[model samples]
Target: MQSLNEILLQKKIKEIRFKAIASIVCGFLSIIPYLGVLFALASWILFFIVLYDLKIYGGTKNLFKNLFIVAGIGFFGILINVSVLFVILKPRIDIFGGLYFNEDNAFLAIGTFCVLFYITLALIFPFFKAFYYEIARVTKQKYFINAFWAYFIGICTLPLFGLGAIGVLIGYILKLVAWIKFKEFDEQEIVNLEERLAKEQKKVFDLKWIKITMASFIILNLLVLVFIIFQYFISFVGLDYNAELYIRRTLFYIATILALLSVFLFCKKLKTYKLFIYFLIWQGLSVFCDYILFTPPSIIMSKTAYGSLIIVLNLCCIILAFLFFKSLVQITKEKLFYLVFIFFTCNGFVAICYTSLLITLNHLVFEKLFLVGIILFQVAYFISFLIFWLKLKGQKSVKIC
Candidate 1:
């Protein structure tokens, strides 16, 4: 009994020390804003050393397996993020002014890439760790790497024409299957830990409440439908100036709905749900913030200043969207990775051209260009819908046949 008491006291002391060290480290990391990349690198190095020591001391096979799993997740995250980044930034090598793929620019780009990498690890590592505990002896990090590598190669094999798009779909399916197969975790560790803990972790958001609230909120937003109807009426009646109010009101109402969705999404604990939610949120927030912060008079200071601010904000939004997707891939829905990547990439490209498109479309000739762009967007949407339908049909046929 005395020996058991001593052991318990020692364990308590160790836990206290561990928590204190963790708190200090977290405090220091939080203090540095842009230094998160450096901070994460340091944390990872420290983690490896500590884990190595722990593995040696315990001689636990599970520890080594967990190390592999985490490393694999890190690799998967880095590959997916960097690949999408390459697609987005590759086209702007010449036109973006400064960084023409020079060494300094390259270093900056690589360093910036770490921003996404670190953000992903920070958010998902705990989940992976928790998952590691749950899966017990069956969990191995190599499985995740192998799964990701296979998916990467498949994507690389995508055909250059529209078949490339089909390749993306197949690649997505392959990745999804791999993850599902590899997600074989044992809940024994979690159950055992729960027996020792004071309390179990509580669910952050209730799904039932979420559903009910969203449905009600969506119903309330039908007033925006009325505003949109009023806009057509004003436009048809030749009240050109009144039509501007209708348009503004219509957009504002849409923005409000988007903002609400974003808030609900932001509150969500899952990344995939947050991804689409944040996308709408950013769009809504940008429009709403711009309306409030930059009236025409405020933006008339200098053309460069206005342009620079908008560019900076748009870039910030793109980064946020990436972070949102990273969270989604790691957390809520891993299957949505390719779709999320393509959607964000397409939207980011649109944002980059949005202001220019607006400026040019003020001319009569550009009206045709605007119409063409709208038509193209519609066509792309229809094509995507058709592909989705075909894939669904294929899935059903496979299940049946």
Candidate 2:
């Protein structure tokens, strides 16, 4: 019979294999049109599982704990900034007429928000550096350093078109190299490292529950996709406004409910990261606000009130997308760069444009622009997915070992 240490070592090896396979799969699936998001979400769960396993069995608790602390602080800073903005802008919000900020007030608010945003960035940078530095140290490779610099440069040159893309591509390449090296670490060293973990007993997670939850999530996503298709078809057919609104609202509400349930289940099972929960909260609120807006009599709210609610929801969605991307980067780093680009260009831009549309609903030009934006967004996502699938299919899978 195998000794306890041997059993543990085998388990760790299996997990490493799983993580490598998952990363590869995620990279491949990220190119698929609408389904890429669902696959990415699943990959996030797998990444979290790998992290948890590493924390418990690989003696990397401090590294993960510190990373989580930094992430939490960053999230908190964003919340604080948002709260402050709300406070500053509340008086300027004319419930009946919408935002009425004068030129001076608008400038002041923008300046203040920018200052706070920079401060938050400054505070978060060191933590990220430390995290990357540790990964490099563990892997005994300088690729992570390359990734760090590349990503930093990318962020700095974000205003430039081609420059940012180049930086991102370089960063992603380095990150992939680092991850591959980390996965190929000496087995004896891993066994030695796990010795320290033996002293601390950890609870075993039920694999069955995880499978069930994931299955449910997949089903919910499919339902959502169906609803989206039907709704789009209705729009294309030029249905009556009342009929279209009713169909859209009903399908949207149902889809939202299913999405919320799936997210809740995943959170309950994982219980580690709060990013998913934060997203769920914002999503639910957004749907609720939409409900209010679409309901008859306008729920006794003025146009300004409805618009503000939509704006808030869109802001929350933007934050949610940022968190999602951050979480993916934490796991895949450079390997996620291309998908990250697609997400920002498609979903992220959609959110921003939608928010702008909500803010200027009265403007015919803005309304027309939004319609065009939506079509472009869909096309971009589809093209990205096709590219990913083609590239992945063309490549041969290399053994991790």
Candidate 3:
């Protein structure tokens, strides 16, 4: 028996090594020009390798069960890329843009799409892994169905990817802690506390930590966005003005530092209520800084280049503020009624600023088009949110009454 166990473990280790090598090879193959077909083959090979690796571990049944989930996600992604290519390229007669495509622009589009897709997949992969592990741990029958439900959480939570990344990171930490806890439980005389303790411990992962981590990421990404906007305006609008760009760049750095410090404080694991209070304080100060520091000078230095910066700043603040409000609802367990009002008000502020800025710049069509998209998103989200709120309220009221 001991010899057999040793052989099994060696085989598993070898399988893991092979899978890792195959994954790396496939990653490299994906970047070669005119090799997308080969890349797809490598991706399929990588998928099988992953499955084989899982089987070599204790997760053979899990790989079998959740195969559909793995296939569905990957296939959908490839399908969307294909759809986009067909839609964009089919109309243009330029071979680079069409059936015989050969332009740098076409290659650029393909490369950019591939990079973005992979980055998105890399970010969300952990959630899928966690869900698979949980399904195997928690259920004995209908493994596929259970795994699908868990995976559905990831799918449904797409809009919250910015926030979900925080949850997923916490989930990774919990995974390590969970393994330790599982070992501890296995050694204990008492076992009923396992699930209870697992859940109770997660309270430490409450909303405050999530908010701070998310805010830090958003701020950093915003800085990158600002730089890209600066470059675009400079390139296209002939706004080769260096002083304006320098000021905006300096402000972006300042915001990034503040965001980092905010994240550090949250990492210290302060009490949730205290952290919430600090969040309010920081945001209030941010508003002050925005009005006093960024706004006045941005206006006084008004030019086409600066206009883009103002628009970007306004968009970032509005979106971040909306997310903060959403987090408050989730944390405070408040009714969604209040959130609707808040969302509208927040977006109204964004629209007003955007319109006023565009009007000041005399850009009518651009402002109108942007406002249309904003209004549509808000309206659609509002209606969907109302339905959800009503359903939740009914469920609660029935339980109480």
RMSD each, Å: 21.2, 17.1, 19.5
Model 1 lDDT tens row, 283-349: 5445544553335625455544554556667677667767765664565334444464465456445
Model 2: per-residue lDDT, tens digit, 157-223? 6545557778977887777666666644434346666455544323343334433443444344444
Specify the poorest-scoring 10-residue window by lDDT in model 2.
392-401
lDDT of 3 by residue, 1-401 (tens): 55654464445445444544555455556566433333444445445655543443433445554566656767787677777765555544664545454354576666656665665466547556654554345322233334344444444444454554444444434333332222111112123433433443444333344344445444554554455455543354544556556655555545444443443333323323333334433444344434443344455675555555545555555555566545546644765645564655555566657646764665565655555555554654455443433333211111000
Where is the poorest 10-residue window by lDDT in model 3? 392-401
**Winner by lDDT:** 2
Distance from true location, Cα of 180 in model 2, Å:
2.7
Question: Using Cα atoms with residue i matched to residue i, what is each candidate's TM-score against the true structure?
Answer: 0.33, 0.45, 0.25
In order, candidate lDDTs are: 0.45, 0.57, 0.47
Where model 2 places Cα greater than 4 Å from the true spot, the runs are: 1-21, 24-34, 83-110, 156-169, 186-191, 194-401
CA shift of 159, model 1, Å: 72
Q: After TM-score superposition, what is the CA distance of residue 302 in candidate 1 from its true location, in Å?
A: 3.8
In model 1, which regions exceed 4 Å deviation? 1-235, 238-285, 288-294, 297-299, 337-341, 357-364, 371-401
Q: What is the lDDT of residue 288 in candidate 1?
A: 43
Q: How well does candidate 1 score on lDDT at residue 198?
A: 28
Give the clashing pairs for model 1.
68-141, 69-141, 134-186, 135-185, 135-186, 271-328, 272-328
**Pairs with backbone N, CA or C atoms under 3 Å apart (clashes), candidate 2:** 31-385, 172-334
Report the poorest 10 consecutive residues by lDDT, candidate 1: 392-401
